[model samples]
Target: MKRRQTNTNFFDLTNLSGDIRGGAISFLVAVPLCLGIALASGAPLFAGIIAGLVGGLVVGLFSRSALSISGPEAGLIVVTLSAIETLGSFPAFLLATCIAGLMQIGLGFARAGMVSNFFPSSVIKGMLAGIGIILIIKQLPHLVGYDADAAEGLALFQPGGFNIIEQLRMSLGQFSGVAMLIALSSLAVFYLWGRLLFQQRAFVKNVPAALIVVLLGIFINELVRMVFPQLALRGNHLVQLPVPGSPQEFLQLFTMPDFSQWNNPLVYTSAVAIALVASLEALLSVEATDELDPLKRKTPANHELKAQGIGNIVSGLIGGIPLTSVIVRSSVSINAGARTRLAALVHGTLLLICVVTLPTLLNKIPWASLAAILLVTGYKLARIEVFKGVFAEGPAKFIPFAVTIIAILLTDLLTGIGIGMITGIVFILREHYQNTHRVRTEHANNITRIHVSLGDHVSFLSKAKLLKLLKNIPDNAVVEIDGTGSSYIDSDVIKAIENFGVAACQRNIQLVFLPARPAESPVYTLTELADNYRRNNSERGFRHDSQPHLHRQVNPTPI
Candidate 1:
């Protein structure tokens, strides 16, 4: 029998070693991801690296989740790009990043993390699927070696006039044969290695297929370039590292925001937009990471908010893009067998080393390989299995999921998520209304007895149902409303019930409230009646203290 250790603390040496191994794998994964996200975000390539490092080191140190990896995210590309444009410069955007971080910290302190619970599962899942599709479509051009001078960090598809199919068609005509071959080959090798060989080999099981694909792609690209000098792919298509002449030159790359922009209202407006979008993305990523954790550990959402705030602050200070709990890196960490937060810490250290010492080797890496990796990531995220599962859940779930997917494909991420969320909320409200005002009439001893059962939650949206149920009640009928089981009885439902009570009184109908308490005045509106009942119940230890054994009693009210 294994003895249980008293200490559940995070610093065990065994755990640390696992974290180190996981971190190394995460580092390898993050390098390409950081560069890709940065390139996608329209920021300098180095800025993405800085965000990844800070996310790993700072956020990793402060975060409560042992397995979460943080960095620049593709989801935040729109916000970052807009911030840069609105703020007029990268430095001005840095200021907004700092302010957004501060706002997140404040939200944490306010304990607003529980707000995520309000988001429906269907909507969140739909958003993830949408992002996955976006990732695949956006990276397609780079995979085919047609480097269009388009905005880097925008969504894969554009709304209104611009569309993904049109962009894809344009990109296909300008494809590079060499780059395409390298990308397709890298993808094939990755799939074969992960599928056929990984299951049989212990040593290679933990090795990232992405790293192997990258190495193979680089080698193939180099060989092709040597043999065909006339069809040379320019260095611009490859990853470029800023070659610093000296320590001073390297220091020059670190730029601070000009606070003079603070006076501009547009800057503040952009900051607000950045803060909202970044917060939403961070919350969503945190939720996704929690779900992906193998240990089933729940991350303290508020703590995560504070950690992200700290990461953004540090990232901004050093001229890095704003950071978040990125799904790609977090997923990589889990897939790599990270056991603790130390893995995240180690990943940051590896990033620092790569940027500082391996700039030349890093620059040699091809865009096609990274695109292949992202393509695989996209496939994993928007798997057909998810669609099948949604369909199995019934039309209610499928509608929101399909709507979100289409909305994202047609418009943008935020718009798509918004539509899905709205649809989900509407569904919930409809269900609530249906459940709350169910009226069943029983005919006994020449009198009609009506039983009304309110739902678990009764809000203003349920008023229509309540009114309709009350209007159909037989004249002089005995009515009994059961609110004892209700957890939430809203004011609207209360008002409607009160009006029904008055009508019942005029018709000589007797109205009885179930789980009745002594000294409770029956002459009150629905809202007042519920409030009065609640007060009486609290004093008498009714309804909430224990389940009362329900028994039907004879009543003398006439119908």
Candidate 2:
């Protein structure tokens, strides 16, 4: 098969129209997502916009993925929230984000992009599911117009002794009918927009559901203001963007990281966590985008990592959140016929332009509308089908998956992933132990014969089971252990078989060993093997862990 060409040139304006159109559509989709994720992260609202710009301009320039879009990701909301909260200051958290960027660059140089492959799919799914559940719980407050803790970190239980249930109860007491009305209406728009897509209408397909939600929100609030001034949403109830009258003021909006936090150990810890999660999310998104690419282009994972690292560095220095290659925006771009990195670059340029020129228009967007977008996103991540699919994969997959979710909800992201990794390893070892060999026993002409066939690979994990199987053999029985199918057999297994031969001598059993190489197959009477074991022990001071230097028997040797 011929290799596909990765020949997309940056200056190739052949697909300029397509790229521009795709970028515009993705920009509409990204607006609410960036705002919502920033809100969720408890960071300054403009931080998300900064990350979006860096993701598109910087990462898009450096990454080999032509269609993938990079921006502040929903997956990192929990991480960002915890990091900011733990550091006690957004500037300090910016320090961590910078460190994370450097770490990602180091990872790229070390060629560690493949590290994500070590993560089990089940655990990743569970992590997303856990984040989804938390997203819903956190957004509930905003959806109900309780914006007191809008800038707080997301935890099932907060430092203020308020749990998810308690927060919901409190939000209920402070619920605004106007906020709920807008949120529900936004959801309704999303549903209707989805239905419109099914009709294959060109105009409907072009319009983003999020853009509709934002417009609806603005219109509804405006209507309320004119008709019932008492119920209009304002202040914290709306999106708050810092409108700058000049370029100097716009530059002032970018906050620099507090370099003094370099000595903080917690900063390094958060950095590591952010780098790992961002890299994994990027790798997953890149892989997904490759599959979606019409040209079937393969992204160079290391380059992508390096690009993300640089993007994060820029974002961090400018008071933005960590970024990842977001699949949602990428898919939207692809569906909109994006053909090159130009599409992403265009999106970033548009975001910069919009924020600088239309901060007031953006501010008119209600938090309730953004919350509604996130609610839909969170629902998609932890939908019933996701759970059902995992459950269908059986306990081997579902157990660790469920455990990761519970652990993340109760403890935190890093802790939950660690626990899930250990659990996945345990299940793997259990499977290896139980399936190392296939065993069969037969009785014919008043004689018992047992056969054991080793699997393709036998490790120390199978030693105990192998011993038990040998021990269960009755006296005067003939046993044959075949290792021909095994490409690699552990030394521990060989030692067990040798010891069993010594023990079989006293029981008057016959042992036949079939080594992985058929030419090395041997038949030996238990007595001969026992004599060799004793002789070898005397001559070489052989211990149990020592190699079993069993020689090939000359002929059919009798006891």
Candidate 3:
């Protein structure tokens, strides 16, 4: 028998080319977002990059999730900013972040990460779609060369109460033709590669289209600078990476956490908040990334939590922001053909190497080109087919999926997920109400015969429906309530059944209630037992209140 390849090995060289290509493209995409998130969090620009480094290197090394990329999460920006302000210093906040990591480690050991299993599949898909929509909308300004609101693009609302749509409208009027050219040109190249090159050419497919687009963007912009200097993209229009001139200046980038503030209660409070938020984000990302994996492999959630905890600890130690698995970067890596964790390691390594050695080279790439890459990725994530597939699964799935997308657009991620979760739970309860029991009625002469077959493992959720069902039985009817099929029936349901016997006597209905089988009962089919009970009861004849005598004779299971 052949041994199955369950997961890709850490040092697997079979996919080195693809991992490198994916990693390099991911590195390109991550740089600006890292800077943008750090700017939003009121941290040093380099801090986000450092978090990305620890997330990718440390978390990736230990995480069981093959494609999940961890880094400075945009969702934590408000939390970090508030913590920093409340703590009176960034270093103090860093100490809190380190404490948060310890808490996350505790949660992992306690297996709290399994809480992610309760999230409905529809909600997870909706989250991906919501993030996709956000990406497309937020990147629009960059695609058009509008750079004023760069740091806050990921936020749903700006400081002036302007939404993303308003920002888009404002940016359109002041758009740069040069930036538009680059973005449009890059998108066109992506379209061509997807439509023609990927399926037909093997060698060329190995080289990521994103890399080609970046190189083309550089060549075009440089050419424009030489020939028509006025039309060339410049300054803020391109990536702005802060370069360190000396070894001493590079050392200044790393900030140590302030350990003296251990006595402050605020630090502990901040730690709890960060721990909860970061762990939730990481678990959600793990779930979403697993859904996107072509191999359909599942990530061990607790392992992922531990990995994220370690990443955050190292990040805080080095003056970096709190880190979590980010779905956007993970999706980008998946789309770029990453097959192993090595891609994550490579991306982190590139973040360190490029910032130190090729910051000038990175500065040449236009934001428009990067935006084009994200736009394509966003389209893929929220494709029409995904919506169609969910819709085909019926309203039970689609409603939550659609609601989650809309909620995320209207509010933030966690709030939207909570709403979606509640919506999913409502549907679940509705299903339980309708499906807990099956009722069939037949007419014979002037009387009615009704059979109520309880479902396996009936719970308290079905209590109301069961009572309503019992109340609706007409007078002068013969009722048989069978629970022989149930492995475990709730006490609430049993009480309802017991109470219905009293109502049956008043209504002049004959009731025969069969409780669930006992654990030590002999091996006998439920159908056989139900048939034997009906035969015996009919032969001896039953009164309107024969339930007590019937139970004494048969000595049936007590529930």
Give the alpha carbon lDDT tens digit for every residue of 1-559 in model 2: 2222343455346777667767876776576667767988889878988999899888888887888999998669878999999999999999999899999999999999876566777887877787678767778888888765544233476355337777788889988989999999999887886784554887665566666787898999999999999999999788666788899988877999999999999999999999999988898678656756788777778878999999999999998999999866776676656888889999998888888888788778888887776677667668899999999999989999999888878866557777887888788888787788877667778888676777877677888988888888898887877665766666677778787776676787877655353223243322333356556643332222122223333232111
Provide TM-scores for the models.
Answer: 0.83, 0.77, 0.90
Best by TM-score: 3
What lDDT is obtained when candidate 2 is compared to the true structure?
0.77
Deviation in Å, model 3, residue 420 alpha carbon: 1.1
Model 3: lDDT of residue 154: 43
Model 1 has an lDDT value of: 0.72
Candidate 1 lDDT over residue span 1-559, tens digit each: 1111211234457566556666875676577667766776768877888999999989888888767788887668777887787767888888888877888898899988887777777887787787778767877887878655223332545643335677678778877887888889988876777675565886566555666777887888788879986554556567666667778877876778767777877767776776677777778777776666666666778888888888888898788998888776666666556667787888998888878878778778777776777677777778899899988998778888888888877777677778888898878766665566555667878899777766666667778867877787777677778766566666666666666665665676766666423224333333446456456533332122123335375442312
Minimal lDDT window, size 10, model 3: 550-559
Across 1-559, the per-residue lDDT of candidate 3 in tens digits comes to 1112434356457778877877788888888888878988899999988998888889889887888888998889878988998999999999999999999999999999889999999999999998898888888888888865545334465355338778788789878888888899999889888875465988567789898899988988999999999989988778888899998999999999999999999999999999999999999988999899887777888878888889888999999999999988888888998878888999999998888889899999998898888898889889999999999999999999999998888878888898999999999988877788887776768888777778886788988888888788888898887776777677677667656665666677787656445534443433334455456544333332222223212322221
Candidate 3 lDDT (Cα, 0 to 1): 0.82
Which candidate, 1 or 2, has the higher lDDT?
A: 2
lDDT of 2 at 274: 96
Candidate ordering by TM-score (highest first): 3, 1, 2
- The per-prediction CA RMSD against the true structure, in angstroms, equals 5.8, 7.0, 5.4
